[model samples]
Target: MKLLDSGFRRNDNKLFFLTFYDIASPKTGGNMAGKKKGRKISGKKAGLSPGSLVYVGSRTDEPVRISIMDYDADRIDEIPEATLDDIKKCMARDSVTWVNVSGIHDTAIVEAVGRLYHLHPLALEDIVNTRHRAKLDDYENHLFLVLKMVIQEPETIRIVFEHVCLVIGPDYLISFQEREGDVFGPVRERLRKTKGRIRKSGPDYLGYALMDMIVDHYYEVLDQLGEEIEAIQEEALSNPTAKMRRAIHDARRQVVVLRKTIWPLREIVAGLLRGESKLFQDGTMIFLQDVYDHVVQVIDTVETYRDLLTGAMETYMSSVSNKMNETMKVLTIMATLFIPLTFLAGVYGMNFKYMPELEWRYAYPSFWGIVLVVFLAMLLWFKNKNWL
Candidate 1:
């Protein structure tokens, strides 16, 4: 869960360095373990609720770490720890510098970075508050972007969501992740190896590369969901148990959650592409368009899965109805066969000695024969009617 960043300039130099430590590091004090216990607080004290600091990203209390990558086409320099002096040095250099910070639990460090870059207080607030939705705000000097990075657990089919904030400045890019694990490994490797146009592009392209990685993960999650939906469909058809019903319901719930996460993302990316922002360049619009397309694909896939799950629910209901009707049909036919036979038994069990059927032994045999014949006749009728 270490953090790293690679910076590339138009001139082709690349610098790479690790930025932060994982939350489990000793410095974090294991604050991410569970919910903080407390008594109910009212009025001003409520503002200090432990949950006030929304744990929108990771539950880690890791110390904030920073790294700087300064590079130009000819030469590159990597600084493992990017202090205020390092930022000033990189700003004075004739290269593209990328400062990456990991761990947002420390508000002071966040404010310091904001102050160094002359970032707006609102943007700084958004940075410190990890629960903010995915968004892109354009300031004259830079673009502030908030995005959620999701990872699917292989064993549980559960998703863990994290927030990654980006500040695209004039000559530099600053990325902040709530946790240490980042999906930007490919982008890092590409920058390090000088693969493709990454080194040749500007800072906006770097922002696109990072955004593109986040969107790519949306596809992976949808793919996993598609598999799960297919399994639920099969289970609903073959053996519609109560467990299967619950599975369908849970699948639908997940679809709802996925929709909530993805639908707004479409708008956010679309806003970035449509609006005029200093962070986005004309050449970078095409990349943003690609990301936008990916968002649309993810949305469509989510919707399709939702529709399929709904159909499965209907099918399950129909199956249950058919089973109930079959059970009732058997009970009805048994009742129909016994009605006349029960009447005959009642007549014979009567205590009246004057009844002619009770006078002789032959009469008793005759009454039994009549009862048997009636029972057989009712069976034949039921069979003919296909009620058997």
Candidate 2:
């Protein structure tokens, strides 16, 4: 049950490191433990109201980090960390403002941001509950998007699942994450350089960029998984041990979880493409469509991996069975060769008063000679029959 490796990249400040549980790693309490954690999280809100703000995830004491990027065609302001006053000033500007919250374990941070943006209480509730699935909810004034961002280590194939929520308004977009590091670094760089149409676009287009970055990273994860699947398949065909079978099953379960986590984003993206919310502009629908295509490709890759795992399991079982059959065939041939020898010895072993062969001078040597001849004859017959 030793884990593959830790895939997360720790920050230099070392404020806090996020813990990512893999469905494939047994040492990290695979699917059953995930279920128990889910139940425990649900119990925390058993008696609470629907809109009650409760952090339903791993508890941490680290302070939440808030960063902002306010940009228009001409100028862009980047704040590594912003205070509420700074956020207020950014809100006053007539530009696309992006507020990124690094952690959501604190209900107060979410509550404060909710109040500033006039977000629905239910939306705030979903934001704090980190286990929510990928979805889209429209609240007339803005759109709420929940997504699971998958991060995989290139060398170890270790995967981390992070919860991402986006609340897109007319001129601003607020994003909430469970931890500090993200794939959004590229999107932030693009914003800083004023690259492409992102600088001239609205919040909807920026939202698309963030989601697109996440979806594109899925290819990297899938590539790692693809190599792992090939390795497992080779091991199953060659070794076919008990441990290999477990690896195959664990891999299949991982693929299932990946499929479930990513499948919903397709509908969410398609909803945006169909103009389900006014927050998404018509100019951004084409880009959203591209994101939708990426989601489909990710889904297809996941499906293909699932099938490959199934075939690996079958191959493992077949290899094991064929091995057993060979062992049983050799044992049967050995027993068949001994049958005549045993009968001859039994006949001579009878307590006869005067047995001709028992009294012979060379009886024992001749008996061994006959036994060797019979053994060689049977072996030759078996070889000819191709059962050897």
Candidate 3:
């Protein structure tokens, strides 16, 4: 991993190390940054000047990987790991140049790329922060886009998001990701096989394809959440437990996060469709419209899921309350039935010497008969009142 010597003094390096150490520390609930379970706080840059290139995210040991894909209608050149010279060569050509940087922990790569492409310092800063939500910033020569690549953990409804930034220029598109994996495999495949209009399109179209894939993956996440809701619903009705209640809450949280991440995307795509930025071409507007529609659908689905989970949570609470009420009713009825029996026993146990009951042998039996009659009358009354 190449380090940015100029960007980090010795003290700055220590500060960076201490910040990441805090992120990796095992302390629990020291002071929650937010409600997120394992999110890294962006407070590392709190006191820093604007456009400082501090990596405020999960750290990694893997070396930075830069891949290049330069293509046009005739042919394509693919570089698995591109050097600076290779990037420059690709950028000089008339073909569409795509430079994909897989890791951003090393500020050198970001700095070098920024110098090469004349990217704004603020844009580069946001690229490494990893906590910014989806947004768009149009510069004089390029359009900067921040998007989240979301994935649900296996066999669980937990959603993980990776920050991605795309800089779309006239002939080149530079992408920066927090990690190496992405949903751009299909787009890569299309470019390789010359399958469609992608090879003939500009970098904006490529950006659209990448964004579209991310949006499409939201459908899969929604499907998983939908299944989780159904299971929670069934369990809630049958037997609501504390664990099940927690599951409902967790699912609701996931939906909320998904909604917040995806909601702003609609506005971003709509802005592109409205020709707010000249980076997007007229030909790309239709495709951006499609993406906008998909965003709308995803937002609608998220809303529906949010409402469903809320309803599920309500149903779980209601079921629990009903069970409690039922138990209390049964206990109340039993207590009511014992009230008269206790009263008669108390009345007969008095130690008065001239008590009339002590003079008769049948006093005890008469008392027992009176108790049975009272109990039976109360029981009958309860049955008639439908309170049994």
Q: Rate the local accuracy (lDDT) of all candidates.
A: 0.70, 0.79, 0.77
lDDT of 3 at 116: 95
Residues 1-388 of candidate 1 have per-residue lDDT tens digits of 3221111111122111111111222211222222211222123323554323322333444567788877665556788766878888888877678888877767678778888889877787677565567877887898888777766544332355666789998788999877555677777767777735777677888888988888897788677667667776776777777877777776676677668777778887888888577666788898889888988988888899889989999988888888889889999888887899899889888898688767777987888799899989989988898888
Prediction 3 global C-alpha lDDT? 0.77
The C-alpha local distance difference test score for the whole of candidate 2 amounts to 0.79
TM-scores across all candidates?
Answer: 0.80, 0.89, 0.84
The per-candidate count of clashes, in order, stands at: 2, 0, 0
Q: Model 2: per-residue lDDT, tens digit, 146-249? A: 99887754333357676789999999999998766677877887888755699999999999999998898789777867766787788788888887776777
Query: Which ranking of candidates, highest lDDT first?
Result: 2, 3, 1
Distance from true location, Cα of 164 in model 2, Å: 0.7
Give the CA lDDT, 0 to 100, for residue 38 in model 1. Answer: 20
What lDDT, from 0 to 1, does candidate 1 have?
Answer: 0.70
The candidate that wins on TM-score is 2
Off by over 4 Å in 2: 1-42, 154-157
**Can you give the lDDT of residue 344 in candidate 1?**
87
Best by lDDT: 2
Off by over 4 Å in 1: 1-59, 74-84, 362-372
